[model samples]
Target: MRLAHAHSVQQSGAYVRKFGAAALLLALCSSVGVIATSGTPATAAGDATSASRARTDELTLRTGQTLAKVKASIPSGSYAGAYVDPSSGTLRVLVTQQAKAPALDTRADAPLELVKARYSLAYLEQRMGEVFAAREKLNGKNSRIVSVDVDEAANSLQVAVDGPIDAALRGRITRLAPDTPLELVQGNSFAPQRYAGSRVDDFAPWSAGVFIYNKTTGGGCSSGPGVHVGSTKYMVTAAHCATATGQQFYQGHQDVPSVTPELVGTVANRSGYPNLDAMLVNGNTANTVYRSWYNFYTASSAPWESLTGQTVCTGGAYSGERCGLVIGQTNVCSDSLRSCGLTIATGPVNTVAAGEGDSGGPVYITAPGLRYSGIVTGPVNPANSITCLNYPSGLRSCSNAIVFTRIQNILAYFGASLN
Candidate 1:
């Protein structure tokens, strides 16, 4: 189950629901052959426009390869920080202990720069864990936290509390990790959404934008990318979209009129928070697939191994297709303080990306030919409200933001493959 997704969705009437996602198709790049070659400094800044564009292009092409090689070669706890900086058209690396950072010989041939940070990456992650634990103490009314964002840019672990942070709670967070940056903001928490699926006997076209269902619970959700484990077909979706596995899988919705859907697959498996919120719908020859994949989302196609400043576009039934930028990563936890998981952060896209019943849609990059990426995870509200940004909007852009799960982790977890 190579994870590829896009979209923002909420399952109506469900308590522990899953986040929506994008379903991007994996398209290979021709220049992939040179991903290993170190980038030459851009020519004298003539085409401030052309020169900048060239740098960005180079950054996108090499970020993934460079990051992968860095992650693979670095020691456990040595990976201080790494990000794709669109502004500089370079990959930046932050080291807590400069002497312990990876040797230049280990870096791939990408446009990269290195710096030093006050804290080690591992320590910050550990502090974030403590902050999540502290958030569990807050009652939903006074200081409920919706999400915890990892802001490497600010070198802080941001906590998005649903409301204002009281004095006592503030002190606790401050005391937990005195040196750690634990910033808080306000926003409404998520709720369940309606408009999703059920199974049918006839053979209906199982394409993107259709509904999906879990037979046991009879709940409805949208379909994402049409994938296959070898020749076996599957519908990649959020694990929470369905309640139980080993049950029958259906399409479209019996509640929504105007048409019918087919019995395309079965609830093969699922995993909730703490792990990736995704599942595989095992379909067979009986399933009819149409334009079941991404449309012209990117200029071409690419993989999901890069991040930070990279762009992520998504598609859903209600919102259609749209593109957004990769901002950062986010972590979400439940009341019991158990179901904790991290997701790829994006959005406030300039297009309608996700909508009601659009869970498990599709997401990719649009410029380099709809390069496939990962699935939609959830939404986040910036720690600040002065800026009316972060809402999914039109091509002109508006306030919006989105979160998704990386396909690299998805494929590695499910042991699946894609082009």
Candidate 2:
């Protein structure tokens, strides 16, 4: 309905906020953690611990460090939290801080069981590399995963995972390697685009256009204010926008057919094909031609390592204009598109943040004019759920986060440099 701040009381609740009784039911279901249980003694024994225990186990950290040593070292201020990965059978130790400390406690009465298990140095090294690689592949870029050595002597793990590695994975790694030195690599081929500004109603000095393609009816469907990448025109819309077989591009301000509509480019390389529902549109000359009329700014080539708290803006046919702060970025892989994620924000934007016809509008950071940020791909509405096959009967699920095609990746795909 209306595009409002994510923190607003109306919007700031859990996923079930809009569902009412259904939400309460879902919460109950989650708390119970059991769907069906057989009436057998073994089943009853299994039920001794609720299914939520299993879920909690999944998130819990078990360490492999000896109990005596862990207990003896507990008061050293070096220990934090510990857990074990059931899937990998590795112990993970979360360090609270980095400081000099005595050796781990190896007393027989130490509470090692309570501390959870930890992985061997070698295992952690390999696992860190695997995480690094996974993030790189997902981000469609490269990065390094620095290994941390956990020593009983120091009571800390010196970890390093950072740089211009990949946007999708950066946040995760940062969370996993908290307080560690993460060097973000920059100046690489894949960099994130900054938000410019949006097109207000009948706004002057800002070129406004729509992204369109032919539908089955011999007519056309359109979405607009395609973002400009460089001298070449490009629009960021949903992959579904150009999914029609005979798709064509249209450039205009409103839904009305242009008096002399020019043919812009159609979607070429689309990510989040199935799940994310995003696409990249290569504009025709008509697209770039319209940009001249408005004081449109070109995309930036600079790589944005992170956007938390950074002021941003968006310009679209629907949500005329809005501004806010970058909250976070996440990597989301759906059946349609893999290795894709989006950067999210909360702010005072247009009334209707986005609508059906606003799929390809640009999301930018505006100072006075506009610095190209990203293209609006999808809405983060709670009503929209991702169709994922997690249930036995095949079901879809919903999440609070929205998805977008990273602008930096789009510009690189077209071989266009952001200003």
Candidate 3:
């Protein structure tokens, strides 16, 4: 069956080898930017709208580029995070020393604000690692440390947990790192799970965040990219969502027994935390895999890329589309999934929070170019989650904290590219 799946990917279309659909689609979209593409829904961007989008796109790119310059211009361990403020359309860099921070300006003339932070990114990373290690020290000492994240916006390292951190744990954190600020939460902030919904016979028109069911068991997850290893194809999803390699996946929504879905792919687990989350769907390569942030029928989409402070969006079958800003990046650890494979730390982007069922969905940006940069690996539990786009009051909206595993890493792992 694996051999057959490989054959199907190689045979998805001969045209791809000669004139890949991806290349053709890029050309078509480029000639007239997708934000400006015709036949789009009425709400789609118009010519003027496209022009404005172009300007914002350029601004977002400039913000990131400028932030990079500022970041590099300063010595290491000087700043915590850089962000493009959506409201003010400004570039803000978190600095450990007010005077030592670089004084730079973006071409967009975006405002630059250097705010003092208690710790630099380098220090935070170093200490966060210690904090993670500290979790073991506090095993039964009464702290509910589910995961730890660097909250640059707040200039502190925020810890997510199933419950509160007692005085002893807080004291331990302070003693471990006197320079760092700390905050505690009492629940799984990023909960990725199957939401209740009816069945869909087939994902006729393929989309990145379409429904994917566990064929033998009874549940579903959203489909990720149609990734390939050499010619062997696979799909993407959260590791917590997939139990093992060859675990059957289908295009159905109903639970098992009530639904025996046609096999689309089996599990091909990627490098993901066994207990926490992340995974891949290996097969169904012959089928079209749409990597859109919105549309399911679009023939081509952007490749996976990454930039720290750019704006982006997320899409899941459960929650259609949610757009937000890029906060930064962090690595999360869990007491669950308790092994090397399960406990291994995952580098995840802190941005564009999505709700339940959005796990394994794509995190992307539209400016400079529309592309899928990473996969949603957060909102691991159903607690106070934010609805996609329904910000301020939705599930997993705290800090609008959606985490992602970079696509570049995923592609590199498989030694393959998108079809």
The predictions' CA RMSDs to the true structure, in order, are 20.2, 17.0, 18.3
RMSD, model 3, all Cα superposed?
18.3
TM-score of each: 0.45, 0.40, 0.43
What candidate 2 gets wrong by more than 4 Å, as runs, is 1-235, 244-246, 253-258, 275-282, 285-295, 298-306, 332-339, 348-351, 367-369, 384-403, 412-416
Off by over 4 Å in 3: 1-206, 255-260, 275-277, 286-302, 330-352, 380-383, 386-400
Q: Once model 2 is optimally superposed onto the true structure by TM-score, how far is the C-alpha of residue 199 displaced, in angstroms?
A: 6.6
lDDT of 1 at 188: 41
Q: lDDT tens digits, residues 1-419, model 3?
A: 00000011233422111111111111112211121111111111221233333443344345545666677776667777865565676778888765454555444445677888777877776777787777767534444465665667777777655555677777877888786788876643222222232223434323466666565443345666666667676666665454346778776454334544567767765343432234567665422323332234321232534444556666554454566645343222222111011101112344335544555666655432235666665432223232333211222221244445555545533455665
**What's the residue-level lDDT of 378 in candidate 1?**
39
How many clashing residue pairs are found in candidate 3? 27
Worst 10 residues of 2 by lDDT: 19-28
After TM-score superposition, the amount by which residue 55's alpha carbon in candidate 1 deviates from its true location, in angstroms, is: 36
Report, for all candidates in order, the number of backbone clashes.
42, 47, 27
Better of 1 and 3 by TM-score: 1
